[model samples]
Target chain A: MAVEVVYRSSRDLERLFMDKAEADRHDKMLELAEALASALQNAAPTLSEKQADDLGIFMARHRELFARAFKNNPEALAELPALEKN
Target chain B: MAVEVVYRSSRDLERLFMDKAEADRHDKMLELAEALASALQNAAPTLSEKQADDLGIFMARHRELFARAFKNNPEALAELPALEKN
Candidate 1:
């Protein structure tokens, strides 16, 4: 009989972003989207195809908020992470 | 009126991501979310507060898809971009 040990590591998306602030912004955006979707679902359990389209429009409009937020937080965009030169 | 030249620069979120591949992934994720939301809205033009909640929940659920997609693209996570050693 052979025993195998499995190891699992934490899934941190921070690795994808340039810095902690950027990652934090992404996390907040996801949370906001989730909250909005949940609120919509609770208000109307049933949605027609047309209603779905409206919801999407709302989301698209709100997406601009991310850029606006970034504009207000110039520090987040102050400098690009220096890339390694090979 | 005093003539003032105003300059506008491109708002590139790619600067936030670690690399081009990571930025591409983020862009795809946003596009998919917008599409889904748009489809949902078109299907149902009107949504109550509860319906909004449902949409938020849906967005939250799909958020995990980003991680799953990343897992399939291990190259995106191969190694962190080396930080500048000051």
Candidate 2:
């Protein structure tokens, strides 16, 4: 028998993950991001100026380094260093 | 001690975000994306031309609508129309 449960948007997928990656799943996220990035390049033919700007900004934030933060635990942002020293 | 299982790099956090979002965690993705974008703009002060170009491209793919595709289920990509006709 299968049981279905409702999930709320507020607490949805947003709650999981960490700074470098999840306790268990980090590689998959990298693969998916790469695939999704490829898809958008091929599928999206046109976008307005602002739309393009949003795209640029969003992509930069999903850095392999910082994304790890989101990967380990989504709430890890609080503990991540505010600045990455070069 | 918490039992720690090894996660394969092939299946990391990268696999999670769909084109638009995820099922239960769609809003979280959006919120976090926004926060992440802001953090990068403030934190990273240097980048080469290629790095900046990559940023522009990645941000475009995370459309609010397409992200919904991810939120519903991560595997929905095969079904996502190769081209979303305007």
lDDT of 2: 0.41
Tell me how many clashing residue pairs each candidate has: 52, 44
A79 Cα displacement, candidate 2 (Å) = 16
> What is the per-residue lDDT of model 1 for residues B36-67, given as tens digits with 9 covering 90 to 100?
34434343445455554444334423444322
- The TM-score between candidate 1 and the true structure equals 0.27
lDDT of 2 by residue, B1-86 (tens): 98654322221344433343242354454445554444444444443344333432333234333343333323434545566443
**Candidate 1 off by > 4 Å:** A1-86, B1-15, B48-86
Model 1 docking category: incorrect
For A1-86, candidate 2 gives per-residue lDDT tens digits of 87654332222355444443342234444334444444444444443343333433333234443444344333444444566442
Tell me how many residue pairs clash in candidate 2.
44
